[model samples]
Target chain A: MAGEIKCNNCGLDNKPGAILCEVCSEPLEVTVGASVPIIASSSAAHTPASAVGIIGRACGLVVGGNVIDREFELPKDDFGFTIGRTDLDQGIIPDVDLTKFAEKVKIGQDVGYTVSRKQAIIIRRMGRLYLRAIGGAKTMIKPQNTDWKELLKDQEEEILVGSRFRFGGSEGYVIFEVV
Target chain B: MQVELTLGQRYLPITDEAEVIFLLRLLRDSQKQSADLALDLRKILDRSGSMDEPADGGLTRIQALKAAVNESLSLLRQGKDRLCIVVFDDTMKVILDPTIVGDINAIKKLIDGVRTGGSTNLSNPLRYTLEDVKPMDGSLPKIIIFTDGNVNAPSAAAEERACLELARQANRLGIPFAVFGTGIDYNEKFLKNMAEVAGHGSYFEHVKQVGAMRLRLEDEMENLKSVQDLDVRIGITAEPVVEILEAFKYVPQQLALPVSGKIVKDEFPGLDVRGQAYLIKTKVHAGKAVGDFKIATIALSWQGVAGAGVKSMNVVVNFTADEKLISPVDKTVRNTVLNTEGTKATLSGQYNRAQTLFTTSGNTGMAKKVETLAKSDEDAKRTLRTVTVTEANKGIIGKKGAK
Candidate 1:
């Protein structure tokens, strides 16, 4: 019995079954994994059309000001990258998606974003997962039964989480979906 | 973040004069390698609505003044020139205290923010300025009052009395107040009186000509001349029977000319002379037109470094049987001083020498040369020196006084 609702704090419109607002960490009425349909209100229709394309690979999420936007230009070669305002667009993901599913995210769709200096690696195949397991097994051979050991995938790289950082060498949180 | 530039190029930060003074000292010690002479500039700016009146410039009169002030500050790259601003309507407001103008842009913004609206009040600002500017004991302090029109100032006699009292106070404190009137609408008589009472001098000019005024005021601020006495009385000799019309002092402070026409002269008793310097346009008497001309002599009683003493200089003017053909003797004297090869050569030589010193040792020998050249020029040597320094100074001294 899911119903539509808005988050009390931050006034972010969310699904009735949602537990929290994605924009701000405010509690919502809907519970997690609720089967609710989040309807966009008439006022939401007035939202300006965002020009930012879908983030196909890893994209950085910029949470500045009340309106959150994202930069889409991906790193091409082994050179440094800078996020320009020209490359970004404002986006908001419907609250229903956040409350319903954590895994099996819809591709090419906007999702809740956090401004963290972490990159999410695209899981292409089982072979790469297998390779990460092998690398983790060899690096910490004396590790006991801890899921933490399995978390160290071969694709995982060291990352410095601060205001400024190098792109390639560090493993930063990446955006899987873009709107 | 407001900056108040004194005498144009010298920056005076409103937030902290001591900080600016320290910075100036540091610059002089490290870069300029000269004495850490600090400039303490106290400015009284009129904020009456009249200043907001549309002018030929894109902005209003007040806006132009702000621009001029900022332009003046650009030259103070390294110096102990402190700036303070007194903004006034009917009442007075100290927007930026007499501090070193650290940032001229900031001062511009602060000045720009001064919207024009209200009656004129010269007293409050003058009073505040007199109280605010206190130099480092021996340092020189300067107070500059800028206005557009006459004081909506409380009645003439009362205002005059109050201004005189203020001048006396300023005299006691050794602070000199100089005035710059922006437009013709300004009551020259009142401003002149105020300037006299403030123990300084006043000018009447166009707002567009403020740059000239700035130059004259800056000269006075820099050297901080010890005005031994003002209102130096000059009497004419009884021979030539010359009728003096008017006289102006060419102080090298800013503006096209210092106190235009007879603004400052009214304060001093007119020295009726029998010389060529005094030639009235109208005839005194119908038959007396062809009579002998008399010359006027200004007796200057100055308290020089040596002691108190007096000196008399003659100003002669001549009138022919036809009063229309009257000529002033001072004009000839000035022309002689200006066009003469010896005087011109001596002055140019001294100027070149000063320039050489400036280039070689990075010193302001120009100021010293001016002080030296003023001695034989006139009785009010420093005042005249003020007129000779910059375009502003030239304007104060009058075009005839320029050499």
Candidate 2:
């Protein structure tokens, strides 16, 4: 059952371990199922809505509100995040009241509110992962897409039924799947 | 596509997380409907009261409120309308604070932790709420108060005074208030009256039907309108022919002035200010197209300067059409009558009624009170006033453009 995964952007078929499409240089994320069957199962059931809460830490190099350098760090309980002048300059200026942003992303660190445009960038990290689990062990899972509602809702039944669970950490790992 | 908008407006904040979350949720929902809401509950709520009440729901007014509040919280959550509950009996406490109802266990825990007992001091609780709801700068602040009765301790009057001060602060800060009375013994008149004064609505409910109360709360919350740079003021023209006397009131008619304050609205106000252009809407009179009418002058004194400790900016508007000597109402007689009638009715507590006298004349009350329980409070009598002016010659006469 050797199958090839093709890149939509460059129309390139990348190898199992390929980081980028060999033909067009597009980013290619590959997962090996033999070693981690859970990864394949999780991907099949992934939803976009869960991205909001699953996002434990995000490093966005914004140049004008549009993310230029977007990275989701692994969930860590103590890594500090900053939305400095660069973050503000990149596009969306942070307000003193971080309610809107906080709703989209759970804020666990002291956000840099005074960071001016261009001079500051937003480095959002977390102090602890606030996720629910079946036996108290944090799960290591990631969805193919980042839509918050669909992710959370599709997992709602799994979450409320059986030993199924979902969890996140300060390390940016939002894991929740039925094993 | 993500569009970024910059809001330079300033406001106070509530350091308490739950309170902030609760208020913010309410604010976000309201923002979807109206674009000009500017009241910050954080700053006002943070001023007085305990942030946490011991988790216990016993036989007392607090317990009754606990149950009612719990039901309301559920309704808000199920409806996807965010809500927060802050309970203050003898002390201020964040019972449920601000928690989204997606998690069943959290909702159960929040509802189950309701505590009872303590003196009912309304001022501190309200102050704390106002302080805790600092709107995300430029966002209008709105608050809903649920209480058993008047201030509980000997400092009742003092608390009322504090409430008056808070109302003034809310006016300056652009926050509105709504009051709720739970339980039969609760001070319905006082709470309702205060809601009228604070430019918010009021609700009364017994322990049995919190479900009904929840609906009322939802109605008021839904009708809230957001506005920007809304400043209102009153001024006199020629010092009185019939001893013109003095005029006082709450604009948009929901708030009750401290004493003998005339006029009130059971719901929200007009003028949803989401954009920049200041749309000045007022009624004008044409008269017989030939006479002189007396006009009164009014002004909206900007307080942003006061906040910055800078000099205040005052903008003046005349009710008269003719620009005569030293504020004389020597405009067309019919015009003066129409404008003067509006000014009189507004001051006399018939603002909304007067507005309708010309447009529709009959739809007097928007959300009327079903029951009026008596409590012998002089404040209620003083706050009630009626509008008796015709609308044919009505027009808005004030500063058109001043930031």
Candidate 3:
């Protein structure tokens, strides 16, 4: 805890020297010293992740693509949410459960469950949010005005203001908006 | 005909030698010339064991193919359009030659009787169909293929190489071609790469589902009908002797142009109104003049149903020492460039590079897709590349080209 910065927003442990919560992009407290470093990281100083969203504004989600019309609110206060199919016996329960989205979805059935237990996750870093593609099945993303493609699991790319995320079987999909 | 040239970031720092992407748009008013083309179209479909598997809407993949083919035959004009049918399993079999579409019932009956057989043989069908796609009665031939399995004749690699060779031949012949890879079993990258090798008027599609194949084929059919006799030759020159990096036919469908030189060039055979815009990459030198300067020139000529004409335009960008004058890249342009570069990486069998490019381009979605495919089978990796590249190019030019 000495070197690590604890974000006042979400409680995920962040890498050392992080100016914002890696999970919830809220700014961590900085100490005033006699000699300030030449510069902080440009993003960490200029546009904290919270700048893109209100302190408590939730992330909007819309699920489509063969799945029934389903919408849910990803609360800003929670650590984060996942998009994946559910397998209860394996203790695999996604935050934004794909199987629960609709009974019409084939992903929930026994035969062709292509969606992984944990496909993608939305979180923040140094006051900026990002989407990390993870899970057993394939994951894809589409920014506003662009066609659907797979999601990248990286630290640099941030989620655009209007973007959609899809994973798992054919019926697995979710559109994301930073409201 | 109209030609306009634009830069990703209009202002370049005068001090540093810069490499920038230039967007070129070609627009034609085709509404007044609504004359339809007399087309010679050929369909090469795969009838392997996998074709019988259940797909969307409870119909078999073969059934979906038949329905799409039947619907297409009904729209063909008897005298104006001719249709050819070929099926491949262990070997290529011709069901019909370039025959005029007279009775829809007869053509449908022929298609309905084509039975599923042995393993997929891609190279033979592609060669047989593309080798003889000469214009009949002044009607240009359009060869469209649909397959749902990998080449199993000798091996996938052997067949893929053979197909690419045949595609190069078709490219030299000015023949138009399109291919659709249905279901997850097919080698999408090989088919796409093969078609792209045939250059002008080549289209590729990844039917993610067998059920969706019908709609995609139908959509492509409409696109084919709309493709009139628009033969275009484009000649582009850079002022400071820039390196022509890459060019893409950005609208309707995203296909990379084969460009190599200080002066870039491209051609099109029977282009459609739905797919006209282009994006080109160049490393241009900014002179010390500082203010506004002309960097390039675009010359375009086309012969279509409306007649033949030539048009040209000058591309201008600012060479500024003032950092304030430099503008951030336009979002649409940035996305397109990334998609193009990512696709290039995928085509070259560089999955990691493709993933990185996609990640940076803001479509992290494709990055993940590439990552998963990067760890799979060789053929599966090829599919990932195919879908990754093909899917990335969708709607890149927008409806009206980049305004």
* Complex DockQ per candidate: 0.00, 0.01, 0.03
lDDT value, residue A97 of candidate 1: 18
- lDDT tens digits by residue: candidate 2, B110-149: 6566544556666666676666643454433456665545
TM-score rank order: 3, 1, 2
State which candidate has the highest TM-score: 3
lDDT of 1 by residue, A2-60 (tens): 12346776776642212224465333342211111111121122222122222133333
Q: Provide the TM-score, chain A, model 1.
A: 0.17
DockQ score of the complex predicted as candidate 1: 0.00
Identify the superior model by DockQ, candidate 1 or candidate 3: 3
Per-model tally of clashing residue pairs: 89, 105, 12
Compared with the true structure, the alpha-carbon lDDT of candidate 2 equals 0.30
Residue lDDT tens for model 3, B37-84: 676778899999899988666788898888777865655778678888
RMSD score of candidate 2 (Å): 26.4
Candidate 2 C-alpha error for residue A143, in Å: 51
Q: Tell me the alpha-carbon RMSD of every candidate.
A: 35.1, 26.4, 13.6
Interface RMSD of each: 38.1, 32.1, 17.7
TM-scores of the candidates are 0.36, 0.35, 0.62
